[model samples]
Target: MRESLGDFAIGRLDAEEAATVQAHLDGCADCRAELAEVSSVLGPLSTVDAARLGDAPVPSPDLGDRIVAAARAEGRAAERGRSTPRRLTLAAAAAVALLVGGAGGYAAGAYDGIPREPVAVQAMEPGVEVSAVAIPHTWGVEIVLDGDGFASGATYRMVVESKDGREVGAGEFIGTGESKMVCNMNSSVLRGDAEGFKVVDTSGATVLRGDLTAT
Candidate 1:
């Protein structure tokens, strides 16, 4: 029931009705998909700055037309070979957020302003995988690490250091071997002078190391 999707998504329905709707969503992929799309459209609006909406600067004259065209194209692509996808409606809402909020520029994605080229870092220890990307403008780098050999229930420290032998950031996280860890080195550590980076365990053993030179 498309009418019930919004109520279910927002917890507005009573427990009995909500449970029944949830069960239907679980068994119906189309309704579940529509719920996700509706959530995307509603979620941003809910959190958006009310003051910003009031004072949002006037977008370009053609921005509205462009957004509609882009949204239609996106909807067509998403709905191809399927029943009408709600993604286009969601896209239109998102496009409004982007254009209006560009005044308060935010990253479109992780590593949004970062350099496109990825610097390959090799794992010094077995069963560890690390991927890192450095951003030139922000002078920041993000590391995604997966360790499949760490102790199951133990807490460990992940450390990052600059090439000049200065400790940039350190954080403790509890993780299992099957999970991925994300580490972000702020601009303080990514000041374009870091020629090397390191990840050390709690015992002060290096798990991964790499050069930061532009690749």
Candidate 2:
């Protein structure tokens, strides 16, 4: 049940599995606490720049051994019915270290085989400046955006339009209106089928548009 908390936090579990997890969490105080901790870690990790991960410092050679040791210690504590918080913390730390050490491989697999392509972003309204990059994957496309000059506290949606005039919702982000805004959005629409990308406000007004054909 504890092992499934990570997947449950990210909504990766199937309906039945998720329901079971939810039911268990409703009664398990320890698992609920651990789930909150894991969720906090995942939220920031999701925004990590994968392109820069290649430059991350290599971990110590013994990192893998340390992680395995931590896991074994955690299992031993569980079997003994001892307080597991210390062992759990150690295990979590080891897992995070492993992810940092293997970030290069993770980035390579995440982007698939397609090279990152710069999309030409055109401002749809005055005083708006935005830029985007399109990364195509086997499953679909990921858009990386960096910009400013949006309505603060407003929600913006990314819409990907196919060549046939069909539109697919990519993802959404909140605007800060000040400072640079960075967001990563994904869509199930294949890159080859997408003709353009549009960032629109909640009112359906376009703020920025990008041409995928030239990407």
Candidate 3:
């Protein structure tokens, strides 16, 4: 029959849909004839009885050798396939756009010959800036932001805090240009078992934070 009913032909519809299709099939002799033809072609096979299917075909006595040869041939083919490899960009093109934007920070005279530390701008929209904090016993914290366009040079700082209050300990470690930085806490920071953590920058400002859950 000119049909490929898939799971539908088995009368396996759950409820409402089953009733509808069953009704249609019952009234449709053409569909029934197609099913019959399929059944005839199948003969005793029916639903592909595994019991009567018999053992799988045995290979020739030299099967092991043949298999090894085939594997070698395949490996050679794979080696050849691997040969035509393409080079990747030093940084993803998008990174260039982000670096210009703020994903990596910039200095007042970053574009000039003046040397300065680069700031990591969040790679996400609306770029993040440091604000204030009130946590406790946190040591060092590093971070990577999500967004594009970071400044080339400039140190992003954290909001300052005292030894008491909510500010027990806190800080961050920043690299020149990175999507992620580390956070060293004064205490074991359990960021709700998150994928990442957050932190403040050098000047005691909220510089980095994001994605905390799982990889």
Ranking by lDDT: 2, 1, 3
Q: Candidate order by TM-score, highest to lowest?
A: 2, 1, 3
TM-score of 3: 0.27
Off by over 4 Å in 2: 1-114
Ranked by TM-score, the better of candidates 2 and 3 is: 2
- Model number with the top lDDT: 2
TM-score of each: 0.40, 0.49, 0.27
- For candidate 3, lDDT tens digit of each residue in 1-215? 12343334554556776666567667555456676765565645566778867978778999999999999999998787664342234345566657755743432223323222223233232344332112221233222233322233445433223223233233433444434333223334422222333444445454455332321
Comparing 1 and 2 on lDDT, the stronger one: 2
Instruction: Tell me how far the alpha carbon of residue 68 in candidate 2 is from the true structure, in angstroms, after superposition.
Output: 30
Cα distance off (Å), candidate 2, residue 45: 45
Stretches off by above 4 angstroms in model 3 are 1-11, 16-51, 54-57, 85-145, 148-215
Candidates' RMSD to native = 21.6, 20.9, 17.7
